[model samples]
Target: MTSQDRKDGIPAGGAGGEGARVPVTDGLRFAFGTLTVLPVRVTRWDRAAARAGMLCAPAAGLVVGLASAALGGLLLLAGATPLLAAVATVAVPAVLTRGLHLDGLADTADGLGSGRPAEEALRIMKRSDIGPFGVITLLLTLLAQVAAVSGLYGESWARGAVAVAVAAVAARLALTLTCRTGVPPARPDGLGAAVAGTVPVRSAVLAAVLVTALCAAAGGLFGISGSVRHTLAVLAALGAAQLLLRHCVRRFGGVTGDVFGALAETAATVALVVLSLG
Candidate 1:
């Protein structure tokens, strides 16, 4: 398979392009194509396109969040158990995204758990086989997501749906933060290198702040739990991302495609857990 078919797929930017602005439409196409299983036509392959995609990553998350909420809402309306509804909500996004993030999460766990040099750890991550660490991490993280969402649904369907959407958006926002300037790629090539340092710190900060505010507002509107709880959920997700950032940098030397996926899953899971508490 070509490099584009890899876990992180192709990097947003390619060689031999600079100083020209990419259109919003191009960015949308790239974000949707790269981040989701949705069929989108992405013709541009340059630094500009990659930058646009990072900026538009939240848009893709918004779409995924809505779908997750809809699935959970349908299950709840159909008289399914809260646990069942939460499971479906959690499972649907994984299916929709083709389990890309989950794969990343597993690979990251295996890599970090290996306790080897950065080079060896990265090689382990590139292997297609799942290790014991990957399996255990997947089980625990997925269980946490299901349990948290189920608890939130037990409180109120509306609250659960809001939590799902907010978590999805927050997860994608983590990607932008990870790609911010000064962040190094784990390898010299591939998805991590292509997009690493592509996001400016200012842009990342602005996007993160806006996404947080939007999620908080959305949670207040749909959160039967409490506006404060919703705000806390967003903060919790951000905190999760921060922790992941520190850990990945210290452990792997920098971010990789797997790191991005790992961050998203971690943030989403923690956000849901926090929201469930409300």
Candidate 2:
């Protein structure tokens, strides 16, 4: 390991930087290239660059949420059923991200449900095919998301759109927490290793606070009924993300690329569900 690797627990062998510096343009490029199917040219692949990219991930989510809200709102305006509108909204990010997060969620569920040693479970996760556990988890999670968002849209389009945006932003914010310092990568190479332990605890906390405040502010902007309840729903989603983080830490011994995806999907789903119920 290089000195930088030892210092940050990140894999080495990329463009050298005496100290990590993330230009806004490079960060945006990396975030878009990694998180979405958008055609963004990424010129950097080093540890420092990857860390910078992860820090800007939420910006990608903001774009995704805006698109999702637009689609749902359009569908509603066309007199589509609430269920159909919800499905469209849910599918928007899936398509934009190439269902990467869902794949992560499935792999994670399959791995953790295997009841095997960590090494064996990791092997299971690395496989290309999905398993029964993954199938069941994906089915249930998708159903819950569809049902909840559908109900919310059935009530009001503005409220549903705002919730979608908030959930997307919150989901990406969860990544900052997941990558905080001391979190080990699942492997010595790959996406997880490049980003693991990159985020400082201070940065993670600040991101969390900022995301919460933004989501809460969204409730009022959208004229959601029971604005307090909407804010609480965002908190609930964050709480769920925290629980998943703890579970991954315990089950896998640390965070992985799949874990990050799983957290994003789970947090987004929980946020939508809570908002729908409210």
lDDT of 2 at 90: 91
Q: Put down candidate 2 lDDT per residue, 87-161, tens digits, no spaces.
A: 999999999887878988999999999998888998898788999999999999899988988888888888788
Q: What is the C-alpha RMSD of each candidate to the true structure, in Å?
A: 2.2, 4.6
Q: Kindly report which residue stretches of model 1 are placed more than 4 angstroms away from their true locations once superposed.
A: 1-19, 222-225
Each candidate's TM vs. the true structure? 0.93, 0.91
**Which one wins on TM-score?**
1
**Candidate 2 global TM-score:** 0.91
C-alpha lDDT values of all predictions: 0.84, 0.81
